[model samples]
Target chain A: MSKRSDPRLIERVLRGEHAAASRALSLVIDEAPEADALSKAFFPKSGSAQKIGVCGPPGAGKSSLTSRLVAHYRKQKLKIGILAVDPSSPISGGAFLGDRLRIQEHAMDPGVFIRSLANRGMIGGVSYTIFGAMHVLEAWGCDKIIVETVGTGQDEVEIGKVADTIVYVTTPSMGDEIQAMKAGVMEIGDIFVVNKSDLHGSDKALSDLRSAMSLGRTHEAKPWEPPVLGTSALTGKGVDELGKALDDHWTHLKKSEEGRRRLREQHKEELSLYISRRVYRSALDKISDRNLDDLVEHKIDPASLGTKILKK
Target chain B: MESKPFRVLIAKPGLDGHDRGAKVIVRALRDAGFEVIYTGIRQTPEMIAQTALQEDVDAVGLSLLSGAHMTLFPQITKLLKDRGLKDVLVFGGGIIPDEDVAKLKKKGIDQVFGPGTPLTTIVDYLNSRLPSVKKK
Candidate 1:
């Protein structure tokens, strides 16, 4: 648990050495010594790769569409990294990361590196280790990095904190789910994709998404409105348009510098989260288990007890 | 960083269609606070080993219900060992008989767990082998 990250390994990764990137990433996820050093080493050279978040409800073909998006990027001869965040079972700390199954054909391609992160009970639809994984990818010179989120509830807005652009994919029959999203989660998408267009009611899904995106949205204050495009990842329909839409969003970010600002905020947020967790955990370790029993017996109030613990 | 949650892969090797036991163990492993990667059914030894390599997981548990443990489990262990993954412990369960269990251990499987094995029996077996928790 206290393994020091081999600086030689970090050095190999910096030189774009083979297999070193994955090894560095393993250390990153394990929270080994190399993670901090690796982060510090690569962050100054970060912000060069574009980070995009693809999210929606389960069964929305999010993975399929992601495959198409990766193909599109690879055609441009760009290196790609995919971090598919799959929800962990609350009962068992296990997850079925089928995202790789859909995109496994590209497994051997040196240009593509796909790994799935078990959410480990994180509520933001992403694993806590995502930024670290992204760090490895960026340091390895990935041209584009895509984060496919655990298609859960409205919490997917967390992706915006990590990605430059957000693409929310849905199907023709997802109107009910979209209706339930209200304005909060729907407002997060920079581009809306109504996938499975070859199916019936495709038009209705597109209309439903467009209407939801337009109503009471605060982001419209900007010049760009979230565009709703239809795509069928199975037949590769409308994938090009979706790719174009992403390109346009990237161009806008370059023009407005919002991407750079968001990247800075992400780094700051990641650091703060790590600090809060470490500091709070050490504080908790100092508190006695007897105090927990006191709380159950109505012997002490939580606010006062928390304050006392922090003061220690 | 605090000690990481143990990462284990629960896979159904070969052409077995039944995943009920595999899924149940997945829950048990997860609840034990181990990071369980449940690779779906009918995976080849190649696919399972490659997945472990990419994820850099700590251990792999193959759920072999088809009585192919003699052939399937050893094949997977060999593949993993060939890829310089001898350190990645391989454990399994299913209809593996007592006699075959010894055969498997000889063929490189770290442990052979039979069906209905207590969750902690397996969980403890694993936790026992992890490096002792020495403080930084």
Candidate 2:
């Protein structure tokens, strides 16, 4: 836990050495003491790579679409990094990460670097180490970084805070139109994709998504309108369009005031995230078994105990 | 000091279709509190090593039932080493002959578990060997 990151290793990582990058990623994943140094060396080198988040329900072909997107980007000679998140079992604290199985074609490609992550009890579809991982990838010179979140439900909109763009995937007959009209995660999508378009009723799903977007309240004074695109990852259809849409968003973000605002927001979010992590760690460490028992037994009230712990 | 969960990669490295045994091991390893990345079936040595490098797993578990263990297991280990992963523990399971198991150990495979080996034995072996959990 007190490992020191070699400056030579950090240099190798900046030189685009995959092995060194992977090792740095391990340090970040473990939250080892050395990771703070790695982050300090890598943070300025980040923001060059486009961070894209892919989220959807289970069985929605999120992995397959991510694979296609990688292929699409690779065709243009872009270096790609992927972080695929899967849920950890509450009972065993273990996870079966299978997202790489769908994207195995790129396993041998030197231009592609993929890492699997367990949620580690963090909610909102991603692990807490994700930001640090992104820093490593960006420092390693990846032009595009794709973060595939754990299969998300209606409430896991945390991807919006982490990525520059969010692609929300859905399948045909997944839900009623009213479900699309609802608020939470539905409102955070920069691009809404109805994947598995090869299936029947895909047109209906597309129209429903389009109508829902139009009927919902708009982002006042926003320059870019979110597009609802249909894609079939099996046949690789409409994937080209999705790529173009993503590129357009990237360009818009560069040239628009809204984009600059988002970048500022992301930095703010990063600072707050670090503060909250330290606060929680120290606050939780302060709690004792007796204090917990008193709270459970209703002896010490919630407000007073919270104030006492925070004050300490 | 805080330690992360040990990550293990479970892969089938040949044209083997018998995967019930492999799935059982995967489940057992998961239950024993190790994060396992399972590449469904029919993987090449390059794929397995590449995956191990990207995932930064502490150990690699190769399961083969096609009797090609002799040809594939060593190649997988060599590829892992070629990728600068010399410290990763490589283990195999299948119908490997006793003599071949000895040869594999020399070629850098740490251990070989045959059919009918108890799940706890595999789990305990890994827990003891993984660098993530240093033996105290």
Candidate 3:
């Protein structure tokens, strides 16, 4: 009932309490401080789960692809967690949060956990609260985690940096073949998948992808070649093969030091940026003179001043 | 004095654009006296972590309806741990099943509210879980 009494609920959650975990998640979502403590209590035990990032352009059938992958993974009896990030309404700066409607198959599957996040105006494709949720899910013993980004622009490329394996979904109709050739989205893909393959020109799209892959070829002893797979996510065709390919990639990662090194780098970069932001925000909050005193006085340019402050 | 309400970021990570439940929860959280930051949608784990750290939010809530929870949630958790923002609460609500709730709990998810879960329950949970309020 009171914030002070929230610890018991959290305690219950930490001790494998189910109902309390649900309650605590809601509290955290509501931004309650008690939820903060609960998160702290749980943080130490988190981060063992493997995270996979999924991204692509809008209308790429990302939801359908993700849902099929869920079914595929479920067949392996692995505990799965999905984080679907949706686009926010530009006018209200709020998200419709519509991914739930698309993937209704997992609604009753106790082995699956699906959470949606709104972009909330972050420049890159992700939600502010996603990391916390990921950590919580990992600590809960999920073997695999999949993060889906809002499909749009080059921002989704950010998923490549966070996910162990980035699955870039495309459709034959969306001109993804041409889009892939344009550079930004081209290089970030670890695996290229063409969904809605039942449509005409699907083979052409696959060939285009292959040609694109060949064009970017370099001599760096590649561990695994990014493969192009075709699938009709609606009909479940080629879903099994796609799943197998993903599994193969996971296996390759387990055997190589390159994967571990990249993960460490990701962690390092993430931490540094996080700290810088924190320090900058603290300075902003403590500054009492909100008006542009320095800018108006012409003492320093806004861009230069921003860099100077952030450097500290 | 009117205190600066708790800043809460409610985000949808990944490319699943079904966010009706997230919107509903966001409204409920806002009504409960929190300054809610609703990130429009489609976010990477890195973006979400970065936003939380930058915003200095008291809590970060994720809504996932796509089945990418296993991959997405763990990355966010690890990012927070690595960033030393282990104190920020991270929880989620969506189409998660009952069995998965137990698994997520083990992953440090303080809570997991599924479909049909009441808003009042979320409100009460927040009231009970939040730490002592500080006037900004």
Candidate 4:
């Protein structure tokens, strides 16, 4: 384990060797004992990459739009890292990660590194592995890291905690303007894009999104106003504009106090995620089957057993 | 912490547009607790190899129905080898003669599954041959 986290491997990762980066990411995903050391080694080299989160409801063309964004960023010679998250089956604890299908054109590009991750039972459109994976990509010298979340519903706003900028995508005919009015994910967007603008009622979706943005909540004015744009990831329509919007948002973040606050919040979230995972695993490991059976058979209560496990 | 699941890349090479069988394998593998990355149809050898490298899959499953498996399978394995992914288990499935199975294996394909082969057999094969239960 110590040898795996050796300085030579760290050096290769810093040099952006594909094999090293992949190996480092696997260590993190597997939660190997050396992952802590690797994370510490990579932490200082990270934070330079622009982290963008693409999220929306299922079938909203999140993957397609993410591929378009990768292309847009690559045009400027920026090395990009893509982490596409897919759902894991609760029944089998496995996943079918197919997001790479849309981005296959970039499969052979040296400037781009794309990996598909199973959500691994995380409910907020991403897995706990994501934070570590992002650090690995950042350490690998990716100028931009785009995380495409598993299709999220209204409340899966965890991306807002992880990404520097969130691009919320949606398609037409999803619902009425009221759908956008109801708060949850709609509020987290730094940029709202109505993808598949070529489809019917795209204009209406665009208008609805715009109207929703204008009806901001009671909070004081934010320096950055979320822009609502229409785009077609298929024909490359409005993608360039979306790219510029992302860049502008990054610039805005760098200059604003909100950006620093977001950085602090991101670190806090990372720490909490790590602690939660550790606690969950340890608690489960400490639970005895007798206690589990007792709880299941109503011989003991859950709260008492939960407290007992924590004490243990 | 959650145990890392074995990741596999299931790709279709050559001009075979039908992915029904590949999709079935994908689902079966997923149900059997493997993370399966399915690159749709008509994937070139280069694309498959690149995806496997980036995904860092423990295995690459090539499904070819276009009868070009003889050429494409070796190309993919060679590409994977050249890219420092020789450790990745390379497997194939399609309509191939029994004689070609040994030939494919000699060229770096680890295993071949024919049509109507039981899904559990495929699952068990992966479970047994995957490099380690712990790490990729």
DockQ of candidate 4 is 0.68
The window of 10 residues in a row where model 3 chain B has the poorest summed lDDT is B127-136
Model 1 interface RMSD over true interface Cα atoms: 4.1
Per-residue lDDT for B87-108 in model 4, tens only? 7898999888898999999999
TM-score for the A chain of candidate 2: 0.93
What docking grade does candidate 2 earn? medium
- Please provide, for model 3 over A14-98, each residue's C-alpha lDDT reduced to its tens digit, 9 standing for 90 to 100: 4543334444544554444465576677667654666777788877888888889889988989878777787655454434554
Interface RMSD of each: 4.1, 2.6, 11.7, 2.4
Consecutive 10-residue window with the lowest summed lDDT within model 3 chain A? A14-23
Considering only N, C-alpha and C atoms within 3 Å, which residue pairs clash in candidate 2?
none
All predictions: root-mean-square deviation over Cα? Answer: 3.6, 2.3, 12.2, 2.1
Per-residue lDDT of candidate 2, residues A1-312 (tens digit): 333346698999999988898989999888877888998999998789889999999889999999999999999999999999999888888888889889988998999999999998889999888899999999999999999999999999888888989999999978768999988889889999999999999999999889888885566855778999999999999999999999999998888886778778777877787788778878888889999899999999989998999999
lDDT of 1 by residue, B70-95 (tens): 88888888888876666778888888
Q: Looking at candidate 2, what is the lDDT of residue A226?
A: 91
Tens-place lDDT digits, model 1, residues A1-312: 434345487677767643577677887766665578888887766778889999899989998899888899889888888888888777755566667767766655678877878776678778777888888888888888999999866555778787888998878887654573575567788898888899999988787777765664684386678898999999999988888988898988888877678878788868776887678778878778899999999899899999988888
lDDT (10s digit) by residue, model 4, range A1-312:
433455587889899898789889988987888789889989997679989999999899999998888888888999999999999999999899989899888888999999999988899999897889999999999999999999988999999999999999999878878899988998889999999999999998899878877887457876888999999998999999999999999999999888898889899999999999999999999888899799879998999889988998
TM-score for candidate 3, please give it: 0.64
Q: Give the Å error, residue B123, model 4.
A: 1.0
